[model samples]
Target: MLIPPRVPNRREDGLLHFDLLPPLSLYVHIPWCVKKCPYCDFYSHAISSAVPEERYLTALEQDLEASLPLIKGRQVSTVFIGGGTPSLLSGDAINKLLVILRNKLLLTPDVEITLEANPGTFDDDKIKAYREAGVNRLSIGIQSFNQKHLDILGRIHDVNQAKRAVEIAMTHFDNVNLDLMYALPHQTKDDLDADLTMAISYDPAHLSLYQLTIEQNTYFAFNPPDLPDEDTVADMQDMIEMMTATAGYEHYEVSAYAKPGRACRHNINYWLFGDYLGIGSGAHSKITVDGKVIRQTRFEQPPTYMLEAGKGRAVDEEFTLSHEDLGFEFMLNALRLTKGFYPEMFEERTALPLDSIRPYLKQAEKRGLLYRDPTIIRPTEKGMLFLNDLQQIFLPDE
Candidate 1:
């Protein structure tokens, strides 16, 4: 009930603009890592030697400059620097990027700046320096606390390294999130319990507990590991929910849990279908103009992205959402939340009357897959379990 006031209008004509609905968030991608994990499918490459820190920074700045027209005068409330290993960048590099953002964008003073760090690539000094450079949050990738499981997942960091990384992050950041994976190949219930215990011992403010899936184009897909069966994965999820709840963390999203007043604002922006600008290699963005929604993606490969920077070739794809597609997209993100969205937001964002979604809502309610009050539309327990089925209801009829 404590929603922030809408973003202010800065236009000279005094006309209301949909782009000013809320302050937009920003995502910057760092595409290099020490090594690629077998089950990972994100756009990233392994660094064989030294990182081209300066060259990459320049390219990123150029990319940001090119994106300025799409998001001019919008205040950025959150910035998430995610990638293969954002921690691999030196504090100076991070600072330089922040400076560029400050110069090019209207970044709020209290912007929630987050960096996704790989344990093996970060040290105490680097962690502290990152804080000094304006990173207010750290999301450390600690897939497992068991050394054997770490090896099986082909992670570069060991159990001890993950522990140290969390410890170091705690010293520098008040807002620290730990990323853990469950349902791994050959993982036992005891292994998952131990991993959760270790993570809880660190007392992180946020947690992203993800279930491992053998994604295509990864080594695991070619020579799959003997992962636990479906029932075990379900049990693992239940155990995680129970333990985290006991520790006073709220399951705000499907995979995210946070202590009181600690949920990630940036990701919340994402799930709410708020506007955001994405910069750097393989980044995607969604924006609204004149009540029409547009989706876009930047160049995928690093070399190609750098070459296209400032040349208008950096943007690889763009699409304007149809009325029905916009409605479906809005529901796709808003329904992912356990609480769902206010009934008014559907019409506000999608430019479709509430009646347009009424039939789908009625069907879902009849099926016991949705909970609808006069004010909000939310998924039921059954719907959460079979979310795909619930989402399909919103698809436009052919």
Candidate 2:
């Protein structure tokens, strides 16, 4: 094993104090995939040949080394390896990367490590090795089991492949999440219901149900597909919530459903406005040091990031969040939760007083978009439906 880099303690005793520091999570992005999906806008590149495994691993380590000083004392509560297709990396590579991360970061025992995999990617041995590599969760991307829908979505795997992936995952791991998209182009209510039924049949621990939307610069944006009308899409969302709840899964986040004690901790952290260190190409990090939050972004291109990592300067852009920026950011994340957030959490996470958004909160409540008690503040059913309008109230004042 390689020796980890030393973390510098740059804080003075008086300046280092924080009333409360939010939980830290690590997000490692894998930018390469067999092919890029059209509706997807996240930074991803298509690759057909061999993956540069060793080089990327080394770069990731150096990326962390450069980050150590910023997050000196906090412990990482969870890790999520997301991407173009993290499963594309070999099992041995995953083991090696986890080993190095464990050596460097103060990860808790029983830490939740998750990896995102596409259908048709892994088999029995690979899943087993991932479990051994300290990855406790697997999120299988099964957009839809309907063959026509799958092909329309440009998924490489067939319906059988998606089913087989889940079956193999169940045998090796207990915690699994299925990523399913609804309101796909030309999809009907029955089409969506069937997809949800198939997902529920597997009894995955968690499900991320998102509506497919055309993103700017993607193929779908230019050549928009004929999609379900607004009314039909709304019906689909309603059906999803009722069905998942009936099956005993909690509709936690706006688009997340999970069984008891099976919610995705990493994503929950994000929704709670918690801190995280992001690594790899186009990975973004939000860390609070000495009560001031700073953001950093690695080089956007894979080749550029790899080269920059060698010099311990993978971060191409970095900035401290303004007070107004912090307030808006906190609301942006916290309002995503169905159950909402505690009133005082705003201060703890963003170091901004709750009064910053008090006017907006009042206005939203008056409009029936939110419900506030003495302690907790949550979105109303209307707020969940018109989430964009509710969140817009919290934007930084001009």
Candidate 3:
């Protein structure tokens, strides 16, 4: 690790000081997919021809080189390769990319490296190659086992393919995460129950069950499908909680469940407001320098991002976090966890006094939206149900 020069917190000194910095992670994005789903809003482009795998890898290398200055010496605790379907890249491509990371970055010895894969894009050999390339975890996107729901969501894989993907991943990796979505158009409690049952049957190490929502630019938003009523959706949520609990899974986050010690460390770092450096097209990064926090983003389009990255200037936008921004941002993420955060972490992460947010904390507790004591600050049952309202209590006044 390349340790940066540290200075004292004294204002008189020229340099800034952070007594201790948060853990760091890395996120690599692959922006090409076989097809873009209508309801998807992430910046992923559909490839009509072969993927530009080699060019994209080179661009990622350049982006990482440019970013090393900001994170000199800090060991990356985790690396998550997410995307348009990172599985689309050939196994050799993945190997080369991981080699680049190993050569350039000071990664922790037991770094939790995860790669996101789609059923339609991988085979036994490909999955094996990823495991050989130092990827210790695999997160497979299996939206639904029901053929109708799979088609409705524009997923390329069928029921069999989804099962095969999981089987193959289980063979190659011990740590796996299966993603599923509930509250689809015209879905019912029974539909969700079936999906949950199928997912639980796999006995995956981690489960990320999300509720589908239409975003402004998504196809579902424009041509809205008939969705279940709020009450019906509520029942589905309850059923999910009950079933997963019965299956011996712990609901640690809003939409995540895991076996003992199997929670995604990468995601946990995010919810804890830890720093991460994102590389690749359309990636975003948050880093803390000295005592100030900075946010950055690369260009959204693949072509544009690749072009800029070759010049060692992939970052398109950058900004520093303000005091109010820090307070709101911290709560926005940390509050998502059912376990909440430690009070001292508020000061450690945001570099602000804990007393700063005490009034807002009191307000949330008064409204029965939060419960805080010396040991920890967590959400109550009501707070979890109305999480948006609870998080809003800490928002900076406009």
Candidate 4:
């Protein structure tokens, strides 16, 4: 049971200085889904009648209470309740959770609260209830509108249902994001185009278009489906970006698009290396206290998390970041943005000198994996394709 030690505080220029403390966000994981998608790799379990929603909510509140000491006085500006279909919970249950968050955390009036909703689970009443519970944003999982693609992806909703879900979401929430997947097995360009057009027709404020990937432990992994060729996948990506841009959406991140001023702030916080607290089963968090970055995780199993509620012993482990590790992490996330971070942000966030990362920047620039202007460090087209290689350049020497 060894734990990583926290870094010692140091002084700079006769003034006490610690690592930069970024703004905090909160992530709540809902681990239950109606049915697992074959290509999914997230930590979600199939739903049963024995979900124990009331008890789970109680455990979540207690979990927040125990973590209060660490997050005291920090104002939470964003909260994303993501999952195996967080919309499965009744509106009352959702409201109860929000009530607990408001009571325990410093929730700003304009905080962006996003709940992940599966199309099949959302109804008009549930949508209105969720809106009433203070959820301002909805990210609906509408993977594809093609019936064949839907079946292949194991989505419960049909094309019409998916369209209806978006209409319902827009009616209830001002900001709505549609999640779509492309490059499925035997999927044609026409199929991809139709899905994108259907998604756009709904006039969602944001879009998250992801490429389907086969992951380990999924049914697809054991008997992998014949996926689209690499060239075809690339074509799909190109077409999606073109269509989305033509429709006036900004391709902010690789997979995300947004209307003006509608980018997901919580995800931006993550890409910018801000602090966040992760609550619920199998959640992970990184927080900054007095300049030390503290990383922690909660129990992964539902029963274990419930059993350890209020004891503060639900955490599997806690550790602090090393200086070198922090730099790599900061850049790893920051570089993902098409518009890379400002030069001064590195120093402000990592408490490290600008010169510390010069060598990596020079190497990456030479390889055309990154673009460096006088003020910003952004990834080039080549860099985005080989992101892992670009990130490896920042890793600490062994």
lDDT of all predictions: 0.85, 0.88, 0.90, 0.86
Residues 1-398 of candidate 2 have per-residue lDDT tens digits of 11221212213432323478899999999999888888989899999898899999999999999899988977999999999899998899999999999999999897899999988687878888998888999999999999999889899899999999999999988999999998898899998889999999988899999999889999999999999999999999889989999999999998899999999999989989899999999999998886578899999999999999999999999998766677778888888999999998877787656676777788889999999987999999999999999998877556
- Per-residue CA lDDT of model 1 for 1-398, tens digit only, reads 11121223323453323523644899999988899999999999998987888877888888888778877667899999999899999999999999998889998888999999999988888899899999999999999999998999899998788888998999999999999999998899989999999899888999999999889999999998999998998899899989999998998887899999999999988877888888888988888765466888888888898888757567889887765576677888888888888898765565456676777888899999999998888999889888889999888776
Residue pairs in steric clash, candidate 4?
none
Candidate 1 clash pair list: none
Candidate 2: residue 245 Cα off by (Å): 0.9
Quality of model 2 by C-alpha lDDT: 0.88
TM-score of 3: 0.96
Clashing pairs counted in every model: 0, 0, 2, 0
- Model 3, 209-281: lDDT tens per residue? 9899889898898999888899998999899889999999999999999999999999999999999999999
Deviation from truth (RMSD, Å), model 2: 6.6
Candidates 2 and 3, the one with greater lDDT: 3
Which portions of model 3 miss their true places by more than 4 Å?
1-17
Clashing pairs in 2: none
